[model samples]
Target: MKKISILALMMVFGVVANADTLENVKKQGFMKCGVSTGLTGFAEMGADKKWTGLDVDTCRAVAAAVFGDINKVKIVPLTAKERFTALQSGEIDMLARNTTWTQSRDTSLGVNFAGVNYYDGQGFLVSKKSGIKGAKELDGASVCITAGTTTEMNLADYFKTNNMKYKPISYDTADQVQKGFEAGRCDLITSDASQLYSLRTKMKDPSAYFVLPEIISKEPLGPVVRQGDDVWFNIVKWSLNALVTAEEFGVTQKNVDSLAKSSKNPEIRRLLGVEGKMGENLKLDAKWAYNIIKQIGNYGESFERNVGKGSLLKIGRGVNALWSKGGILYSPPFR
Candidate 1:
């Protein structure tokens, strides 16, 4: 008998070689998603002890795509310092903890950012009694900041670039920073504007503190997953795209079922897996996108309900709005 070629053997076993994170997730009966410790409107446990927020929704969206069940996910709360390590060590399948996409993190860390879920900037949160209306006024003031975040560097850059001097107070968590600020450990706290708002709401008197007008740095926040697994990366990436695309085409949780069944628009049809092999391409069920919309919601809905107008955070869309609506939130074509 003739010896079989190595290429022929590989061809016969290609499926096994291609097995990746998705298979592991499915075998575990759920996806392990890393999230913030407890940032309201992003990834905080409600009074009922259920995880709910924009970041949590992103994790749920991916779960809906992979397992067609929103509840098929285990939330792994992590601090900034521990987040990347969790992903790198395979402790979590994906991370949706409002992490910023920066050069060093993107290149050095063994992870890839799926996409920008929230466009934010660094800002100051100060007590109204201080009468400090802007960030520049806090020149010599000590600043409370969260450790192991991009905000630390941005804070130093902002102060130095403005020819200012200040003392730094670093805490291991956002909760600590909040307490430090309340205890007068620092004159003010600084972080991504969205987090500043979230922290403000948790303050002793929410109305007494306000985010400063000046935005010191661009912070494109999004989900992250380990590098070297294109299949898993694409699934995470497109899960987000599905949400944004649904919003762009006016699809919502309230209307997804109807549209998936009867919509004539080609893009909507493809997105809903009513037409085209969109789900097949991702190794998912035909109703993957539909499950996301039906159970979790579109990006706009998630934003509004968690951090935007519909919630206590009340953050404006700003750059997070859909591109057609005059902000920069745009998704790639589903095709």
Candidate 2:
């Protein structure tokens, strides 16, 4: 019985250790994605049993690039504590959760962040009754934070650097932390500003909990994949770039086909596969990016539909805007 258990574990590890995510995804005819259990605007399911969110679109865009079909994906809902393990174990091809890309995670976790999809920052959500007007007011407050995350370190660093002291109440899941906050287990909850808005919408009275205006730490959140597969990594990276690049080139789902035929801009023409074999460079179809934009729209479109003014979150683009504007969403040229 002991040997059987060991043998099973070894087999699982062997598969994970040897499998090529790109080939596996191609063979399976669909991409496997890990996502938040249920974070509004980032990753969530609706009444129609269909998944929709900004991160979900990331998965769809990748699928469209691979199969020319955006719907060919399987979303695996995972908790904050389980997301990394699932990705490392080859249980999922990529994680499109609202996960922050940090130095420790990038260097130590055997995972590589493709690119920043949303540039966020840490903030606090305090109940209105607490009357915590600013970060300075919470000197000894008990902050609710999720476990197995970079938040713990940031929380300690922020308080220490500011010469403030606080207690921490940690949980394994976002839902647990939010529940603890709602039940009055902590004085405040600290996480990415975007998540604070997402959690606000889940509150019994969202109006009662407002995020503090103090931005504490930078949180560049994006998709992640295993580290060893360069092909899979580039595919995921460029799929996201496809969205941002499409937006920059004035190509969108509604107009990409037209632009592919009529656009006079050399970059746009090459990007839309009218002149160069951009997709061939990635070992995919020439229409790879065209399919992504035509199916998933651009990054801006996904943002508006899932979390921006167009969605219930009502969050602003802020630092997520294109680099040509004010924000820093810049993508490399297809060349």
Candidate 3:
């Protein structure tokens, strides 16, 4: 009986000791990040089998912060219905897909949404020849939309409120919807405006398509991790916050090392791991933010590279701009 009790106690201690995600990641040597199966300009595989996009950047940034090497990440492509389950089942360390933050998702899904990295809204993209001026005009149109997304619910609400009747051609993937819409099986395609832009870019005649002017629902998209892991949650949240704060402080990847050496700003110093115990608090090295910035760059830089003005997506930073610049992209102080 005594031996059995001792063994049971040891097992419990071992389980508790291994529960820290930081420790687990260090032992694993790579962080597993969940991404959309294929959302161009957001999360997709390139010809070289390398992942790139705004969502991919988030995963790389987290990896950089953790292992000091952005390449030390494994991307697991997941569909909308499978993203949450993948995270919850421990199949992925974190999810960086463009998933919306909803109340049910936050509370009932056994996951934690770190923060909103992108402020998006649902909209309709119609062919220019369709002569549909706006979303309000799609009263009785056949809409192609993805299932298991806020787009479906929003479409229902919008049509019901307007007393408009329509048929929803729902699919499980963005590619399916794009193919259906392109085949002329549906009169319109509805999705996040950013997604619509990406899909249109891939269209046979990109110039022939245009997104409607009406913005439907607020879609705060961000990274997600499993619940019951506060340490991992804080690490992910603050890693992203560090990027936003670095941009606000004019700390780019090219200059983060130099700024770390001589920046007199207390916040800058703390953020770059120059003067505070911030990294230690999160069980990371003092140069966590420095690695994130030097390797991944600030949020603005990532956005521009993946989805903003510089990319083929050509999206303007409307609500995604900094808070000081009349947008809602604000982060808490590094201190």
Per-model lDDT: 0.91, 0.89, 0.89
Q: 1-335, model 3: which lDDT tens digit per residue? A: 44544323543565333247777888999999999888878998999999999899889888988999999999999888888767765678999989999998899776889998899999999998999897778878999998888889999999999899999998988888999999998999999999999999889999999998998899999999877788889989998998899899999989988898999999999998889899999888989889999998899999998898779998899989999998999999988
Misplaced by over 4 Å in model 3 are: 1-19
User: Candidate 1, residues 1-335: lDDT per residue as tens digits?
Assistant: 99875534643665322338998898899999999999989999988889999999999999999999999999999999999877876779999998999999999776899998899899998899999987778889999998899999998888889999999999988899999999999999989999999998889899999888899899999999877789899999999999999999999999998898899999999999889999999889999999999998899999999998999999889889999999999899988
TM-score of each candidate structure, all chains considered together? 0.94, 0.94, 0.94
* Model 3 clashing residue pairs (backbone): none
Model 3, position 319: C-alpha lDDT score: 88
- Measured on C-alpha atoms, candidate 1 has an lDDT of 0.91
* Candidate 1 segments whose C-alpha is farther than 4 A from its true place: 1-19
Pairs that collide in candidate 2 are none
Question: On lDDT, who's better, 1 or 2?
Answer: 1
Candidate 1's clash total is 0
- lDDT for 145 in candidate 1 is 94
Candidate 1 lDDT trough over 10 residues, lowest sum: 10-19
